[model samples]
Target chain A: MHISLKPELLFNLGSFPVTNSILTSWIGTLLLIVIAIVVGGNFKRIPAGIQHVFEMVYEMFEGMATEVMGAAGKKFVPLLATLFLFIITSNWLGVLPGVGSLGIYETHAAAPAKDTHAAPAKDAQAKPAAKDAHAAPAAKDAHAAPAKDSHAKDDHGPVFVPLFRGANADLNTTFALAIIVMVIIHVMGIKSAGLSHHLAHFKNPLEIVSEFSKILSFGFRLFGNVFAGEVLLTAMASIFVIITGNNLLAYGALGGFIVFPFLMLEFFVGFIQAFVFAMLTLSFLSLFYKTENSEPHH
Target chain B: MLESLGINPVLMLAQAISFGLLYYVLNRFLFSQIRGALEERSAAVSKTLADKTEIEHRLQAFEQEQKAAQKKVAEEVQKMMLDAKDAAASTKAELVAKAKDAADAEFATAQKRIEQEKVAAEAEVSKHAKTLAQSIVQQLLSEKASDPQWQQEQIKASLESLKQSKS
Candidate 1:
């Protein structure tokens, strides 16, 4: 119900405004690092223990690369692997309790309120009504912090803005990933096929035209999946509270039944979106290579 | 205000930089090691297979050589046994013939000696008969003054007896 298109800005690092999504990505990066070190530290030639699991994951991407690129596909494994691992982990970060839930709230006086108010008109009317009931009687700071017993008895705590948001849910992260993929693909193509041959792909103006669509498709697809999932879960939680009218019952229903299933569903979606993005990149890379090779035949 | 969901260039650049960093770090940590292991494993497997085939070939050749040596020894032993049998048979025949020749010579010598001894005894007996007859004739002559015809008749009869014995 508190759906915002942009990730909330947590703090400013010099001129760079670091958002909650960036924070979550940093978490994902840290998680990946710890696992890599732990797994890499004990790396054995025989590939037993965690190394085995790591190898399986590594091999999965290798197979995808090989499927499209044949023996030459092995070269792209690292890039594809990094993409899948980072995206999937960042996507799943949304489901954590404090991830989208706890934050330093910067309340935009006009916009946030309008989004909450406009929620009913666009989608379900009662959804925002339920969110309002869940948020607080006061529009702004009542949910920001736990104040006093006098205020606690009157209403539920302050409406919180999360300090950490799902990285994939943010346009910045998805677009960045997509742009990076395109850049890598183009670079790889140029490296393999030479600059002239690579540019020949846009000989048809339509090909040039499609590149824009490609960006939208790739970035938006990932962003939509992850962002909508967060919205879906938050809405589902609010729905239960609204229906039950008892805070405890709603929390139980959200945590126990409705949200739990959706959370599990989101995990698979996260993995699948990651897989799709990586595979698409690999496929594009393979196509480039294929043409690069076939052009000689032509 | 940057629209919340709208793409931000600065943020996108930031994310790109982060992604690039992640890619570099991850490649160093995981991908390189796994790839090296994979290549090493492949090489090892192929090497093992090659060595196995080579060993099998050597074993087969060795087995063939062993069989040939065993066969040659068996043939030599068979030849030696046949030679021994032939030598033993020839030696047995020679010993039998030598014994037969010795026995024949001894029998011929014994026969000659028997014949000589028989002749000698007969001659001695004849001599004794002639001497006894002469003595009888002299005694008769003295008694009858002269008996030449009686003595001649006795000598003729003895000579006839000797002739019959000789025949």
Candidate 2:
């Protein structure tokens, strides 16, 4: 099994390397947008169906935000709610059946050489041996020659690059979210307590460190949780495959017995991580606003 | 290190833009609309409740007024009945007195008519007696010229009796 910390590069969009995680982020964004339009397009005082579900989710986040930040938090409900929804959607989408498993084979030469870690390269080279052993009897002869030829050419073989990755699994997406939220928080802080008062908090060295650390904490907390979950599932799946010896029936049964529980665990983790991210942002906002309110005005 | 972790500036910016777009869409469609609906529904409910309370109070007052008016009307009817009864009693008494007076006046007129009739009858009777005695005296004088003094005495006696009865 090939596992990497980085999301696989899907393609280049006019010099921009479109990673799988960003693509998944876009999908999550599009899904949210569609739901927003659908629910927001024809609003009723009495909600039903998908509208009801949407309202329920919205109210849940809204309630949490309001509870955390008081009435001032009412205005930030959209941001908090979007973050929760997008993160959860992307996380859950990552755990889907074909998300990490389904992808095109990219030869090591054709693949981007930027993020070639030794461990993943070794894993990629080892994957073909495992694949040959698991190949069907009818197709083994047909695939063996190519597999041998590819192995003969280079020490490294083709790497399996997934077309989709969990958006939070990528540090870029999580860091982006963290940066945006922190920026907004600071902007709000400045707006509530004049620029000088807001900036004055940075006078203390620890305060500055804490401010920067918050971004790292926010970004890595999500990225680590999601990335770890992906790694755990991959490890568990590889174990199941090894135990079943590539037998389809035994693999299916072992996967159901072993991987299913972990999948459930991942699902729970996904939601918890999303909740943590949102609640943390809300709490931080509350803290900023609370300090702003408590401080004497000039 | 960031590149190894697959953190790209362009992708982060893109994700941020996507999130910003999502936020704008959600704010426009979901949060604002739901908040407005909730506020509107709350206001409508309170207004309706207020209107209901006002109507209930008015209804209660109206019922009380209706009850009071009913009581007043009943009292007025009772008073009118009493007055009518008293007026009827007085009118009956007055009519009885007037009827008694009229009966007394009619009895007096009948009694006076009776007295006048009695006097006229007696006078007619006396006149008839006088005429009969005169005829008897003339017949007797023709039969016996010697008995004139006795016939005159008889006529004088009859005239004395008639005068006593008239008096």
Candidate 3:
């Protein structure tokens, strides 16, 4: 069971570093596109088949949003709906067969790339929680990188690098989503309620601090929940391997019997986290609209 | 680990851009179209329902008018039949009265003509009897010396007998 605090670098795109989370998220986006096409493409006035299912789901969310946000919710439905789909799909992406488990080994020379690639390895070794993750994949690694003798020089040899990771599991992606949500909320507040009214939400010092803290709260809440689920599943898988004396058959049995259950848990966790995030944003936005529309308290 | 898993500035911005783009594109393509189509269709359906109700109301009213018109026509036909019957009854009564008057007049006229003819016939009979009596009397006088009183008595008795016969 490997658990890293940070997402591993899958490959380099010229100068920019592409993390595994980014890859998975892109795949999630592509999947969303495909879903949109299948659901919304051959749409009719009267729906049937896949279109019916899609419309039903959309209407459900729309109804909920309208219930919460009232008339303004009619406009904000797309935002909430998109967030739910994106987060839920990306969260569930980790549960696929070989998400955190399988990957190519990134074995570049530690000396040359060490300065540029300090983020992943350095962040991993620095964190106490990442110690187990570092140790678990190191022993089972195959020498896929160019040089084998060069690995013996450093304390760390080739590390198992997964091609994709859950986007919600990465703190970076979740934080980004959180920040974007906050910015949108504030902007919408200013737009709906005027700048003075929106700014007045921070009348007290503690209120201002609390509002600012929402950035980290929103980001880490999603990141921690999803990442913890990932780590738990990985740890359970590892325990299965250790118990079965590294037998592949026993591992499968443990997975089907035990690990599979947590995967289901993770699935729920993913769905719930997505729901919470979107709903929180929706509720918060609703509040902003309410505050904006209501008479000012002297 | 929490420190490492914490938010990063650069990555947060990147994700923000990604989310924004995805939201914008999806909203434009998928959701807006759904709302538009759904709203338009519902409006059309309601409009059609309203139109249907209106047409039904009109049909009911028209049917009611047709029924009233039919009733009126039936009543007129019955009244016309009654009027024709009354006219026929009155004409029959008048024709019967006229026919009875014409028969009475014809009978009266025929009675008057019979009386006149009877009077004329009696006068002619009287003249012929007078001539026959005179001739008889002259022949008797010539035969047995002038018996005027007896001829007169015979003539009076014959005339009396003729009157009794006529009665």
Candidate with maximal lDDT: 2
Q: How many residue pairs clash in each candidate?
A: 9, 0, 0
DockQ of each: 0.41, 0.54, 0.32
> Model 2 - which docking category?
medium
Q: Give the CAPRI class of candidate 1.
A: acceptable
Q: Per-residue alpha-carbon lDDT of model 3 for A144-248, expressed as tens digits?
A: 332222223443555566666889888888888877788888898888888998888888999878777988899889988988987777666556454544535
**True lDDT of residue A205, candidate 2:** 92
- Give model 3's TM-score versus the native structure: 0.66
Higher-lDDT candidate of 2 and 3: 2
Q: What would the per-residue lDDT of candidate 2 be over residues B48-103, giving only the tens digit for each residue?
A: 99999999999999999999999999999999999999999989988998888898
Q: Which stretches of candidate 2 lie over 4 Å from their true place?
A: A111-155, A243-249, A290-298, B55-167
* lDDT score, candidate 1, position B116: 76
Question: Which model is ahead, 1 or 2, in terms of lDDT?
Answer: 2
What range of 10 consecutive residues in model 3 chain A has the weakest lDDT sum?
A122-131
Q: TM-scores across all candidates?
A: 0.67, 0.66, 0.66
Task: State the lDDT of candidate 1 residue by residue for B1-167, as single tens digits.
Answer: 44535567878888888888888877888778988887898799999999999999999999999999899889888878887887777777777777777777787778877777778777887788778877886777787556678668878999999999999
Give per-residue CA lDDT, model 1, range A1-298, as digits (tens): 3456777655567777777788889889888877887777777888887778768778998887766676778888988889998998898777664566544333344223212222222122222223333332222333333442111333343334555689998998998888888877788878888899889989999987787778889989999999898877666655654455445534533444556677788889998999999988887777666443443111
What is the overall TM-score of model 1 with all chains considered together? Answer: 0.67
Question: Per-residue lDDT for A201-255 in model 2, tens only?
Answer: 7888999899899999999999999998877766565564545445353443444
Worst 10 residues of 1 chain A by lDDT: A114-123
Q: What is the Cα-based lDDT of residue B106 in candidate 3?
A: 85
